[model samples]
Target: MRLPLGLTAAAILFVLTMVGGAILDQLNENMHVRYRDASVALERLEHASERISGLLREAVLDRNVLLTVGYDNLNRTLDTTLNNLEGLAESFGLSREVNLLGLRRLELQDIERRCLKLMDEDRWGEARDLLFGEDFALSRKLYEIDTENLVSVLDDRLRREATRFATARQASLGVRGLALILLLTSGVLFSRRLTRELAEQKRLQRELTAARDELEDRVRERTRELEHANRQLASLSYMDGLTQVANRRRFDVAYPQEWDRAVRHGYPLALLMVDVDQFKAFNDHYGHQAGDQCLQAVARVLRDSARRSGDIVARYGGEEFAVVLPGLDTRAAVAVAEAMRWAVESMRREHCVSDCADVVTISIGVATRQPKPHQEPAELLAEADKALYRAKSAGRNRVMVWSGEDVSFYI
Candidate 1:
């Protein structure tokens, strides 16, 4: 009679174990479905965000109107995804993150509107500026940070849920070991699936990180290229196109800065106003191209003769060049002028139409002054001009120095 009772108890226990194991299996299936759904939704959100970023970046640099359409569709998709995301966030107790995402979405919409308006108006420069502006950069950075944070929070919660699921599986295993032996196989399969999915998730995260890094490197390279181009443009702006020397604008800027330094240091600043002898006649005799060549040759000579790094050689205007010699006295300045004059005479480039020599020549006027605090740089320039007049009046190929109010020929 006892053996029969023991057998009946064992049977009851086995039936109870089977029922409990089935319930646990159902719960695990429900949990797995929710996890899968959340993973799919998060992936959709990531794709949409990445698409929006790429489309907007491309739109800023390119004038393709089609990108606008592409992004607009993505925006609609993003709205739907965000709604789903918000529901999930709320379920996961991430209401604050949801609010932040909503705010960022509105900001992104405003940016898009402004960008689209600029595109419609054909204001690509302004659009580029707006997109690359500090505010826009900051906005994008904040949005990305918020997104990463949301992803991290969701991943953390999911990991906790997975841990709970694992614990429940272990408990089910212990309670129903004899009756639900088949569940061991199911548990092993589920574990393998979870491991594979986690690995895939990690791979996706790594890819996203790599992509972001590549984009940043590209941005940096582009910025460097733009900076180099700007520098080239700025340098070109100050150079004479014909002679490949400093233009009048550069002279104008350097002259005052040098003058201020001279005034402060109590050193003499010298100016040489040089003009090609009979340049107009030379242009008429030799075509304009030859005339330009003549000017370039003279400019090259003047640049070479300056010698000192502090000296400046500039194309002051038509057929005229100016040289600034800082810390040079009148005598030293006259010596430089004479050297330049002698070099051109030695070159002996044939100039049959000249009244001076049979070769091309230049007339130089040298003026040096220890500038006073109250004096203007123009005063020195005028003195140099007067000396230049004296050089031209005296002879075609000579240097004249300004002596107070008078001009003296430099020997």
Candidate 2:
């Protein structure tokens, strides 16, 4: 009776193990399908948004009447994409984000209608302004934020599901182990059957291990891809679209971090506020396109001249640049400022309508501080600005250093 009972228990446990393994495998497969689907939907939405923006730009700026067809097609594609995205978001329990995206879509449509009306009136400037204005940018930014939040929520749920799958796998393993112990105890009475069962169990175990390994590999690969995408998004957020360099947002973030580090380490930190001399006149005489090219050239020079690993070059605003030099005293900082000024002048980009010189020139204001725990980063920035003003007042195309009491020309 005991032998038969043990054999029966072993058989039942084996069956349970197999069922649990099958269920876990199915769950993992379903997770993979959902992950892939959500990723595809996001990529499609991003592509559609980019294409729509391009079409709008062409219609307004280039006055390309033919782009109306492209715009209509993109609108249709975007609608389909958004519908798919909303469905996926709802499925992932992200209904709130879906609603937010819907609201953002409506906002974007209202902005688009006004822009199109302006375009029809041949108010290209107003249309262009509206297309690139704060309202349009805010709407687009909100859309991106909503999508990111949706992805984040979905990712967190998938991680929880993965954990549950791991737990189920462990349960399956324990059931299999118990089955093997029962089979061993009953081997004498049912040696032949036990042998066959053991062999079958070994084969199934091998297959299960292989499946788990493959699933884990897939999950790891997906994680790496998501991480890479996040890194790219962060880079794009910090970079200037026009200059291809660090933007003011990046500058705002870095300054305080560097300042804190300088305060902690008892090291000097330098700030350079640089401006293009007579940039407005240059823009009026040479046109905005030329002005853009000139700024790009100047940015390139500033980026190149600040060769230290700790130096940060950023487009502070239109025709203005800022450089953060870590561990540089007033003397070293002034030298770097002078080098930057010379490099821009050497570019010799023609700015004929300037009172300063025949070619484009930059005025730089240098300020260095051994930051204290009580001091703010803005103090250094303000000093640099004052030095920059004095440089411009004295004459353009020179570097000035702030001495706390007065600003003096560096060269």
Candidate 3:
């Protein structure tokens, strides 16, 4: 009777183990299929974006096609991609991305039309400008952002799948252990140690549960940290790495917002275009590393000088920097520019190669315009830039204002 009971227990445990393994295998297969499908969809969308961009470049920049063939092909391919994305969105619950892509495709079509017309006219420069304009660049940026978001979403899903897989594995293992205990009980029902063994099994089960819970809690905490890191990384995109100030991208964003606000309030918007005097000579003299340090120091001075809540100092490309002074007239703006110039000069960073001054100095052009209807804020920036040129041409280390006057001398 004991032998028969032992055989029966072994048979039941073997069957349960096989069934658990089959279930786990099936779950794993389903998870893999879903992950692969999502990955493939994202890759296809990327392929579409790259292909369209390439065709647009070839048609516009190279003028490889004299006709509208490229445009036709681009439209067809984008339509197909849109259709595919619609299916994927329904299956993957990506409706938001699909809507955004639709809008992007519409904008791309308009841009392509304008570019192809220019190419047809044999005006290559205009074609290139239209193709590479802010609109086109913005569309590409949006697509890139969307692609990253899609990839992130897919990665999150994959992580969730991994967690589910692990949970399933733990549940199967627990069930197998319980089955084994049942088998042992059947074969050793009359043993005096049965109760003690069961008590030990209960303790082991408690430990396993605790370990799983702890592991899950740790994963949650790590996920939160990863999320915070991602946000910080995004913010860094708009920051100048060396000087720790706003970069050109941040400047672009701020410019439009401030311009609109000033326009609404009918206030004068002032812009200061600041240039480090003989910066290239300074770089040639001291090497790029020192040049970077000089830039950082100058940025600090500019930032300190314009500490108003509305003042924005951003590193415009290379050694150039810009300060936007909203609500200030040309005179007040000029005063701020003079302060910035003196602050930088006081740093006395040696620039023996500079023809302007032996110490580091800055040239500034201040322009102020009352925001008017149907007028662009860029006009103001252009005036400030022209004034900056005049400052440099006259002599470096001075503040000049562009007030619709001849800028032959420093004011």
Candidate 4:
């Protein structure tokens, strides 16, 4: 299941809080360890500095005592103390200031060397002068001051580090306490809210399911009603108003299918383009209402004349009708057109305004071809139109067949 954005954010925040708490605890522990290590180093440094100062005082009190003590022993002690000071400095993490301490140690060694040289020459005065010289006195005083400053610095650093550790520890404790409280509160609230939300989600899901089922039932009922209405609409769209024959649109749609079936069966397809002779004059003289009745009678004749089940009769346009006959050759098409013309002549409807003596007549153009593998529907339509023009020109009230040789007339 996927959580909402708000819930996901809350989960992420909870994880981050836990991670932060753990990091704070680790930092606090590290600070305590560092402070303890620093304190130990500071104490060692202070003790070592005091020992070095005591050795210097002893050397000052009795210059002859250095002979009894042996120069090697004193030098060894000083060297050991210097090494200890270096170690202490390192332990205290004062690597950057180690050089200053080393320089002071070197100065002490140079003083010892000078004292040894004087003792070899047995010149007490020069040795005393060398030990108590202004330069040496100044160097010793500077060394003492440096040691005191080091002690003061170490004390201050220890105090500061202690204060820092205390602050950090206290802060960590406060943060942990607050995080614990927040975690408990958030967990409790989230759990309660999650339960409530789940219940609400369940209720909503049930309502949605019920609504969807009801909607589906209504949709099914509406679908049956629409299907019945559609069947009625289809009938109206295809049937001609006057003759109850197929209309042009329906004929156009059905023609292609029939033509394809004829091609598959290697049969002939024929088309007849029929027009009422002098229809315009008849409409002008007999009135439009009479002309309409005439057109209806003509359509009925065409419908009765097309005998085959595969044949379709349709009103092509004003005073023109088309007949599509599958499995009909040129002879069959001509015979059907002649029969339709006779049917109209038998009507005996008078057209007093028309120059022709006939009551009503029809001019029909017939074209027939056996469907071939690559024959296009356009080619057949063009042939039929050519035949139609020929029928119109050769005097109306006759059937004319398209001849393939008349290229110019067709073009």
On TM-score, the leading prediction is 3
- For candidate 4, the per-residue lDDT at 320 reads 83
Q: After superposition, how far is residue 210 of candidate 4 from its true place, in Å?
A: 21
TM-score of model 3 vs. true structure: 0.61
Candidates ranked by lDDT: 2, 1, 3, 4
Candidate with the greatest lDDT versus the true structure: 2
User: Against the hidden reference, what TM-scores do the models get?
Assistant: 0.56, 0.61, 0.61, 0.45
Backbone clash pairs for candidate 1 read: none
lDDT per residue (tens digit) for residues 1-411 in model 2: 455776787888888897889888887887868777877777677666766775676566555444546666776776787788777766568777767877887788788878878887888899889999999999999888877877788889888888989898998989888887787787676777767877887898799799889989988998899789768866876777778888776887898999999999999999999999999999999889988898889888889888788789998877889999999999999988998899889888888888889999999999998999999999999999999999999888999899877636567
Worst 10 residues of 3 by lDDT: 59-68
Clashing pairs in 2: none
lDDT of 1 by residue, 1-411 (tens): 233443345445546765776786677666656555656666676667666765665555446555567777888887887788777676668779867977887787787779778977888888778877887777877887877787787778777877886787677556544433332233453455445644774797699699879978986997798679668866876787789999777898899999999999899999999999999999998999999999999999999999688899999878999999999998888889999999988889889988889999999998899999999999999999999998899877999888886636665
Candidate 3 lDDT, tens digit per residue, 105-192? 6777788778777777788898899888898999878877877887787677668777887788788767666655666666555344
Where does candidate 3 clash, by residue pair?
A: none
lDDT of 4 by residue, 117-172 (tens): 77556666676677668867777667666666666666676677667756765665
- For model 2, where is the 10-residue window of minimal lDDT? 61-70
lDDT of 3: 0.78
Residue 20 in candidate 1 has what lDDT? Answer: 70
